[model samples]
Target: MRDGLSQEPSIEPQIELTRENLIREQDGDSKSIIVETNNSKTTKNSNLHNVIIHPRLKPAPFKIRDAYPTDLPKPTEICTVNDLKFYQNEELPVNRRGFKYKLCKPNPIFTSNYYSTTDIEPYEVSLSWFDRSTGSYLSQDCKALTSNQGWRSVRSNVGIREGIYYFEFKILKSDDYSHVRIGLGRREASIEAPVGFDGYGYGIRDVGGELVFISRRKNVLIEEGFKTGDVIGFEVHLPSLSQQKKEIEEFVNLKKSEIPDHHTTKKRKTNTKNKKFNNIEDNEKFNEFNNILRDQIPTKSKGVLYYDQFEYTKTKMMDHLLNPITVFGEKAIIEMDDKTKNIPIISNSKIVLYKNGVKQNETIENLYSFLPTNLEEIEEINLEPNLKQQSNPNYKNNDDNTLGYYPMLSTFQNGAVSLNAGPEFEYPPENTQIKPLSDRYNEHVIEEWYWDIIDEVEAQYLDSFD
Candidate 1:
């Protein structure tokens, strides 16, 4: 009586549940189920089943695979290539850091001063002059050097870490406004600045014959300043290699500990968002990632793979002045042994100047104090210790082998000077202890022979790796 025609008795709908039905339901391909009642027909979708919730797991942390092989025992004998390979490997017990060690080939013909010698030529020592490739403001023959603008300096082709040697400089041309500074500088000394402008050099200025070191004038060496056509001689004395062997060994050990193995590759996740980097930390991270990528990429020049060569005797300018000379002096004195003291009491090195053939009264003593004894001391002056350790990877400090002096000459404002690295000098000093610089040839020959052996050994060792 309430509705039109549904007054008849209503019955409950019957429903069937099956395993295949549940499987079809989960697959989202189940057909709709129809339930027919006495009063009305009803349709229900199979997807409306009880929902089950499950916990999600975070992705495994990003991992980096180890690039090197298993550790190898330190080689006791380096006679074969395999033994040399083991000796150079980072996994060995003895510490070593470098991409690869290769021997530099020796030149067949070597020329110095006005003399030339070949591998077949008899062994005869000679003096060294200004290296033509090392100076752009020098004469075509490299005998005379002139500078018309700012201060420009050039060093001789050869240098010595030990022994007493003498060289002469003649002021060929100089005006009232022209100036010159003659001295000794290490390889890191800047060629664009005065010789004594930095700690790596010690010079005597022509202005007042003033002794200059670390950019400061210490004292007057000559009462009468040198003029045009004046001859100045320099005498250098350094401790023997045996005397510094202990210190050099300690330095090498320390450097081996500090240097990291550069053979491994580093991976980093880079940001993909296109936004400006306002945070310094983010910028630094980004730069570090880029540098790692750059190092991994191979660089080819003239069809040759350009691996960074080991810089044994050269370093960056900023690295040359890291610590003060006083630090090195303290270490040198404290590390001296009885054997080192048994020799002559000339433990302290010096640089003595001579006007014409006459020796000057003032002497620059404690030359070893100025030389960098360790890699830590090869940083810029006034630079914090932490900052020195953070120097650019490509600008590392030179090895202790490079801790020596080369004949240095500087000129300014059209000043011209000629080198007399001689077997015969216009005015040779009367000092019998000091030998002419030409005698460096004997040392050079011995050094070359030593390096030739090293090169052959390195070649054999590298071949084993391939």
Candidate 2:
């Protein structure tokens, strides 16, 4: 300090260091030590010691284990049954919509006022008349026969031939002005062939209840009854009234081989163009006037399933219409007299079959070919018809005089709403029996993905090191 400048006593006190940190730069000074951190606070105990073990380890056994992994494949098959054990967490499908004729407000309220059981009493009645042609019941003048009760029972002849006449009974209040509950009426028509000519014809409600039209001729015999009409009838038939609803979830497979594609050629004057818009071309101009729209249904390749002939049957009591009934009373019982007679056959047929289109032999032959080669063993027997038709009439109808009144044949209303019919009932049962794996829609690829994911997840494990 004296050589650089002038020597001087600074007004500052010098303090000596008592503690110092010596950081070694050489690697040889480094060493591992135990430190306490929040994460590794267990080492704070002085008793802590390092553990050394071999590389290999033995797995500890567990008393129980889970068989399935988190990566288990989802079930692709649908849950059809409500209580399916495989899918406890899922809900089964159901239809909540009820029948159209179900008791709903306003409709029922309206219907109940008309047939108020609490207020009105129902009645039962039958009608008969004399016929100059048949000599049975005298054919009464229909209008004259209908007691003035706001309705007519007039017997008037209609159709090309004259003999077809209807002795109609309609819904009407009694002349006594007594209101009645009109449910349904039964028809028991028993006609006898005249001595010389024939007596056979058909009847129906051409436009429903408005008019009960009979095809009075030698060739066509139609008979019809009604469950609903405006004029209250002379009487009504009452049976046990009940209602039931059924949910039909069915599977119907269409086989291409059975019902082959067919086409019929005929003359038609209808416009045969697609109406993409209202605009008409010269050829389609014919549609603008008469507006007759004609089109050919485009043919499509046959598929595995087809929607055909769908019918719904309900046993529910309809408020407006009465359930149909077949006669078992004396009105239908008949005894024919022995006399010379010329009979007439009545029909409403457009197509006639010599024999039914039953391939009975073909079905039998196919079943035989499917037998086992060695065939000493027996298989369970299945004796059921494979194909079906509407009604299978077992006998023919005869109108000859030799046929005295035939035991009252079964009678029916042409417009009676029937409960569902045909093979639709069997559909649900068939859909249930099919296995998922056997179906083409459920392919093998789905199963392959399931096992692959399951195995891969099961292969993963927790760290073996402790």
Candidate 3:
């Protein structure tokens, strides 16, 4: 009021109240208000949207500082740092306390794809019929009686329901029966009968090379049967088709009931002709010298189905295959069954047989009952329909719940034979041509042992510090 000539009318105090002013008035005069304005706007046109725009700024470049000792104080005799003093003793260098590092040689590796060390014991049993020696580490060899019709056999250490397996029988000696059969058989088969004598077992027989017999009742004259020092080879191939068929049918074709025994047929004939079978009625004992000649015919039918000669033309060629045995480790490769998870060939599982290095002309099929699944895995898979349907009484399925196959062999009395598995053999069979029984087809599927070994190694490593 003094500087102004009575300052014409203080216009600053005469301002009009706005909505913002009313809000501020209600909030109280203690709160502050800020006003911002773009004073440097450059626009030729009076359009608010035509203002120049600036791009968004990026984040500032960040850097970690280099931490280094610098400008340190000079060392002083009266330092604040507490010195760590270590006392020296007059002990010898050898006895001095230090890291006692000693490298140890690694232990030899023992691997088994099928049975572990403990589970493989059952395969080395000596049954009543077959007398296995003390050296029967893997049940690879056995001694048989020399009596005619006197038979002794044993189930193999490894049973294979599916795959191709080649086993050899070395003729250590021969008796009057002069019969030594080689091939695959079931545990339920009669131990007192040679292989192929019953339906449960299938094999080829060599009688002093005078005659060769295959199947149950088929006999063919040959130059000679296997003699001492002769290496007779038997091959087994479990095709995939057999397993697939088993999945569909409750019973596979091969497991069908065998033909009627001689006594049963003779009784039927007697009823028709008013005559009687006066001989000892033994259903297990079939007449080996029957008039009906056996052929190398593979049949998918299980029961006693009658087929006339006219049906031969319509028979599938694949069903009538007759696999031949070889000698002297000949090279004979024959394709077995269709490959599957357990079989070889990777794409389609089929077992092949080889003598020496040559492949054979024939192949064996229809052997799903002889193969085995992992015992540790059997309990978990017991409820599976496929395994339950394709079950065997000889092996555990329902009660025991174990399913596995071992190598099996049978010999008549007066016939002595030696089996060559991998462990006990003068000339071990080459594993090159065949997939190992201990080999798993798939690697991704881990087992309990895999985790067990891992946990064991970890524990051992941790214990090293103690």
**In order, what lDDT does every prediction score?**
0.46, 0.17, 0.31
* TM-scores, one per candidate: 0.51, 0.13, 0.35
- Tens digit of per-residue lDDT, candidate 1, span 313-374: 32333333322223354463232222211111224678888888788899888653223232
- In what order do the candidates fall by lDDT, top score first? 1, 3, 2
Candidate 1, RMSD to the unseen true structure: 29.9
Candidate 3 — which residues are off by over 4 angstroms?
Answer: 1-149, 175-178, 208-215, 219-223, 239-360, 368-405, 423-433, 436-466
**Candidate 3 TM-score versus the reference:** 0.35
What's each prediction's clash count? 6, 33, 35
lDDT by residue (tens digit), candidate 3, 1-466: 3331212221112223223222212222211111222223323221355434211111111111101111211212211101211111111011001101100110112111101111111123222111121111111112222222345554443345455555555665554644455555544333444565444445555563321122434533222445556665544545553453344233322222222233132221223232434222321123221111111111111111111110011001111123422234767665344312221111233333333334444444434343212111211111111221121111122211112334445555445455554334344446656544333212101322343234335433332322
Higher-TM-score candidate among 1 and 3?
1
Task: Give the distance in Å from residue 186's predicted Cα in candidate 2 to where it truly belongs.
Answer: 19
Worst 10 residues of 3 by lDDT: 306-315
| Residue pairs whose backbone atoms clash in candidate 1 | 127-438, 319-378, 321-379, 321-380, 322-379, 322-380
Better of 1 and 3 by lDDT: 1
Off by over 4 Å in 1: 1-135, 247-347, 368-402
lDDT of 1 at 400: 20
